[model samples]
Target chain A: MRATYMFGAGDVRVIDVPDPVIERPTDAIVRIVRACVCGSDLHPYHGLPATAEGIPMGHEFVGVVEETGRDVATLKKGDLVIAPFAWSDGTCDFCREGLHTSCRHGGFWGRNGIGGGQAEAVRVPLADGTLVKVPVGEDSALLASLLTLSDVYGTGYHAAVKAGVNERTTVTVIGDGAVGLMAVLSAKQLGAERIILMGRHQARTDLGREFGATDVVAERGEAGIAAVRELTGGDGTHTVLEAVGHMPAYRQAIGVVRPGGVISRVGVPQYEEAPIGFGSLFGPNVTLTGGPAPVRAYIEPLLPRVLDGSVNPGRVFDREVGLEQTPEAYKAMDAREALKVLVRP
Target chain B: MRATYMFGAGDVRVIDVPDPVIERPTDAIVRIVRACVCGSDLHPYHGLPATAEGIPMGHEFVGVVEETGRDVATLKKGDLVIAPFAWSDGTCDFCREGLHTSCRHGGFWGRNGIGGGQAEAVRVPLADGTLVKVPVGEDSALLASLLTLSDVYGTGYHAAVKAGVNERTTVTVIGDGAVGLMAVLSAKQLGAERIILMGRHQARTDLGREFGATDVVAERGEAGIAAVRELTGGDGTHTVLEAVGHMPAYRQAIGVVRPGGVISRVGVPQYEEAPIGFGSLFGPNVTLTGGPAPVRAYIEPLLPRVLDGSVNPGRVFDREVGLEQTPEAYKAMDAREALKVLVRP
Candidate 1:
């Protein structure tokens, strides 16, 4: 089986690896049908420190159950399914509370000797709890949108949900990336009346507008804040969706969030320290929330919307490539040539 | 009129000042009946630079309305009222949303030439919005508890409410100060099943236990975290009310919070930066929230409880001082000789 690996910075390759097999009673063997490179994957790609043993790449995927251990009662061979970025036992306390990302028995894919999703076949632990069955056939066009249930779409939705976006809310999304666009869509789905997309890229911002952004601010930093404030009648928005995790993005989030509003950060933060004292969040009563999305909890609820043609989150993937072109997929996404690259295994 | 002023670190004085009079159409002059030295006052008492023009001190107070300007329609002369630490025009968007602390036209009591509460009389701006009239007399025994609605009690309740405390939640309050004890009472009022109070002072912890702390962990740092974790089945509490402003308290909040839990901080954060990255908040899906309590929004709801003697938040006040003893009051609180000091002007 061929899988994706990054040996060093900016270096990605598709190499032959041993095929995955069900090794535990709760495990299942999945033949990857679709997977993708995540924005988070770029973090390690930019500075992972050169290693002789390269790490397996990718955590999102939609696959078919090729084999299942005896204990896997909910799934059978040939079932189509989506896997969240992390695997969790559904019965754990956190999982029962709909916070599957915090499940005690859960772990991320491509870690702890687990096979990455960007492979021909991968072993899925806690299969009954981790995989959500998709009723559509393998050749269905909805597969692209359904695959997003694995991570990005759910992540964007989580930001909006955490920030308490509703029909009465005015929101500002501070990015034009895949997740940011999804946040726009999610906010719209949740009935936010106004959404401002802060991004300089014309193409991406255009897509953002189509997804539900009522206004666009093609500025950054202080100027960006000014533009958002101007759009929001000088009070800023009720919610600022921080889709870019850099310090400046965080700063902008603070700058443009209205007093008593919320800043929901979905981006994996790049730095360890940031201002949250009287000078920022505390003084204005701004709430700082958002983290790894419990995509497993969101997948089922969002699936019906995709099936009903009410949303097309799959539009985030502007390009697609086969297993051998996985390296090009990384290059294109890294260079901003592709918003997100779908990988066909 | 006499008012308390801080000339420098450890230097407090009560000096004669001009009597307050209605200055704006929305203003009202209130004769102080009860005012208190807050934990926050110790901040300036410890490090404020010496100056020829001393800064006025104190914000929380219950007073009798002496005079009202033409626009002050709600407050009448002789009405006893509670003034939140900040004065807001209740008509603002933030105030209408029940976040009066962020009211656009609001300002703290002791800044920008406003008279501090620790004075014989105060000219309160936006009188109709800032003052919540109490149906009690000046000498009512409930005066102490009603005074708490101005700041401390409301601030503590704000932490509990922001953390989403409910019957299902297990709460950990990280300070034994007045606000921390009030948080225990508020958590109990909100029906939190398990309440853990973490503080080293037996006297304060005893008070905290009386306020509804089901368990007390009198340890610090790693031991404190271990003790809290042990109390909550090793998963930590669902909500951590951080009533201490220092970084260590914030660290403890991060350490003992369950995955998907909330850390609601009410303390005026002393530092400008802290960790909220993958190693702390992001990986675990922790929500860091809280800021100044919009006491104006909470006063009415909590007033009924205090009036009925269902809760006694005023027990946090351990001492009393007259106007001439203001200097000593600051000294006693700064030396940890008093939990809180009630001042009679």
Candidate 2:
């Protein structure tokens, strides 16, 4: 089978690899239908400590169950499904508390030892808990939505919810990536009265506006915060969704949120130590929440909305290609030429 | 009137000063009954930025209203009361959101233009919103509780509540100061099943145990995190209250909390920047909430408990002195000679 492997930073390639068979009683094998380049994947591409040689690439995917282990339940061969980036045992205390991303036995799909989704076929362990089955015969356009539910959509929704987005909230979404766009959608769905998307790209900014972004700020750094404050009647937004995981972006998100408001960050921190202003956090009474997304917990609540066409997150997939072209797709994504590039096996 | 002032780091003196009079329509003058040294007060004592002035000292005090301005309606002359550290209008959006500590027009006492409580008489602005009236003719012993209600007790309660303490929660409280000790009591009152007080003094630890602390860990750093984990069946506590405002204490609190659990920080951050691991924060799905002690909001709910004998946090006060000894009290608190020192003016 052909799979994507990273030899070094910016060295992702599609290569022939041995097929995966059930290595654990809970493992299941799936033939991927659609997958995409994720914002988190860019971290390793840009050279973080988590990136390594011979590492499998990609964590978001929608696929069909090709085989299942004897112990797996609630899923069968040929079921169309979406799997979250992190695989959990489903019974750990954190998982039981609906925080699967922090499950005691959970692990990321691509970073450490697991094979990822930017490939033709992949082995998924703990399939019954990690994969959500989509209703059969859904349109292919739903593939984009399913792919998003795997990570970006669930993550963006988690960010919005953590930021306490409600009918009275005025939100500032600090990114133009797929997750940020989806956060704008999530904010709108969560009944935020207004959403300001801070981004610099025309294409992604337009996508953000279409996804319920009521305002846009193309500036960065202090200027970005100034723009948000200017739009929020000079009090700052009531909620800020931080989707870019970097020091500057984090600072911007924290800066533009109103006193007693929140900064919900879904950005995968690219560095081990992100500098935070404790005085600002405590003095302003800000609430900070985010971590690996509890995607498993959000899928059930979000599936009906996605299936019923209440959200059109598929618009984020500006480009689509076959699995064989994933290397070029990675390049395009790295260059910021594509909002999100979908690949089908 | 005489008030305690800081001339420099470690330099405090009881000096004769002009008596305060009503300066605003919402102001009220109070004859301070009891004032106590706070951990935050030591921040300026240890010489941080803005620490080089003859600033009046003290914010936590229980007092009798000596006079009221024309617009002061909720409080009256001769009424006993506990004033929140932060003054708010009580009608702003932040106050209505139960975040009076972060009210738009909020101002702190005992810093800059605000007068301190360690004096014969002090002026309180936003008197109607910031001062909670205690029952008239309350005994002097109630002064201990009333004094605590002004800051430490309320701050501890704020930390516990923000940490989401409840019957099912296993709480770990960092710091053994008056606020941390009160947090042990607060967690117990909130029905926490297991309470661990991290402290070094056997006397204070005994008091904490009496206040419902099921365990005590004198060790700091990794050892402390290990002790908490061992107590929680290797899962760590569900709620952690951080009362010590320092880098090590903050890190320790974060290290010991369980995934999906809450860390409520009442420790005022003295540093402009705090180092946090964003990867670990988001990956573990932890929730952080904190800020200044919202004493005004909690006074109503907790006062009844204090008055009815359902809760008594006054046991934390280990020493009492006349206002003339305010300088010695600060020195004793600085040297950890007293768990908490209550001053009678």
Candidate 3:
């Protein structure tokens, strides 16, 4: 089986690897139907050092179950399904609390000897808890949108939900990436009155507008904060959905969040320390929230919207590639030529 | 008139000061009937450098409206009122949103030439907004609890409310100070099923238990975290109400919070930076929130409970001192000899 691996910074390749097989009674073998490059994957693509064995990649995927262990109860071979970024045992306390990302028995894909999703086939642990069955057929056009439920869309939804966005809220999203656009869509779906998208790219911001951003700010840093505040009547937005996890983005979140509002960061943070004392979050009563999205908990509610054509999150996939072209998929996304690159294995 | 002043670290004195007069149409002069030493007051007492012009002390007070400016509508002369620590004009976006602490026309009690609550009379700006009318008389037995509604009780309740405490939540309060005891009482009032009070003082913890702490963890650092984990089946509590502003209390909040839980810090943070990256909050989905309590917003709802005898937040005050003995009041609280000091002018 061919799988994606990063040989070093800016180096990605599809190489032959041993096929995955169900190794535990709770595991299942999934033949990947679709997968994609993520913005988070760029973190390693930019700084990961070369290794002898290389590192497996990809954490989001939709697949058809090829084989299942005897203990798997709710799923069977040939079921079309989506896998959240992390696998969890549904019965764990954290999982029961709808925080599957922190499940005690769960671990992220592509770690701890697990096969990456950007492969022809992968072993999924805790299959019953990790995979949400999709009623659509493998050939359904809704597959692309349904695939987003596994991570991006659900992540954006989580940011909005955690931030308490509602019809009375004015939101500012500080990224033009697929996740940020999904956040705009989610805020709109949740009934946010206004959304401001801060991005330099015209094409992406245009898509953001289509997704319900009522305003756009092309500036960065202090000027960007001024623009957002101006758009929000000098008070900034009620919620700042921060989908860019860099220090500057975090600073802008602090700058443009209204007093008593929330800053929800969906992007994987690139830095650790940030100001949260009286000078920032504490003085204004700003809430700092957001984390690895527990997409497993969100899939059930968001799936119906995708199936009903009320939302079109698949528009984020501006490019697609075949299994052998996975390397180009990474390059295209890294070069900003593609918002998100879909992969067919 | 006499007012409390902090001339330097470890120094508090009552000194003659000019009587306050209304400087704005919205202002009213409050004759101090009751004032108290706060944990936060100790911050300046412990570290404030010596100065020619000493900082005025105290922010919590229940008083009589001695005089009101022509524009003061809701309050009149001789009315009994509880003033929140901060003053604000009631008609601002932040105030309208129930975030009076962030009111556009608001300021703290002791700053900007305003008289502190410990003075013989305080000229309260935005009288209609900052003071809540208390139905009880100055001689009522509930005066102590009503005084708490000005700061301590309201601040603790803010922590619980911001953390979203409810019947299903297990709460851990990280302080035994007056505010911490108030937090235990607030959590119980909010219906938290399990309340863990983390403090070492026997008398304080005993009062905390009476206030509804189901368990007491007297250990600090790792031992404290372990004790809390053991109490919650190794998952920690669903909500951590942090009433201590120091870094250690913040660290303990991180150590014992369950995944996807909330940390509500009501205490004024003494530090500016803390970890919030993958190694801490982000990975576990912990939401960091809470700030200075908008006591003005909380006073109305909590007043009924205080009046009805269902809650006794006033029990936190263990000692009393006259205005002339304000120096000793600070000493007793600083030495932990008194849970909180009630001041009579």
Candidate 2's residue-wise lDDT over B1-345, tens digit each?
A: 889988888888899888898898999999998888887888888884445458888888888998999999888888998888778889888788888887777788876477898888899988988888888464655778777888999899999988789999899999899889989999998999799999988898999999999999999999988988888888778888998878888788788888878888898865655555554466677777788877778888888878877777888888988999988888888889988898888
Candidate 2 CA-lDDT value: 0.85
TM-score for each predicted model, relative to the true structure = 0.99, 0.96, 0.98
Q: Comparing to the true complex, what docking class would candidate 2 get?
A: medium
Residue A201, model 1: lDDT of: 82
Q: Which ten residues in a row have the lowest lDDT in candidate 3 chain A?
A: A229-238
**How good is the docking of model 1, as DockQ?**
0.88
TM-score of chain B of each: 0.99, 0.95, 0.99
Query: Least lDDT summed over 10 consecutive residues: which range in candidate 1 chain B?
Result: B329-338
Model 2 ranges off by over 4 Å: A48-53, A111-113, B48-53
True contacts kept of 2: 0.80
Sort all candidates by TM-score, best to worst. 1, 3, 2
lDDT of 2 at B271: 60
Alpha carbon lDDT at B314, candidate 3: 90
**Predictions: Cα RMSD each:** 1.1, 1.9, 1.4
Worst 10 residues of 1 chain A by lDDT: A45-54
Q: Can you tell me the DockQ of model 2?
A: 0.68
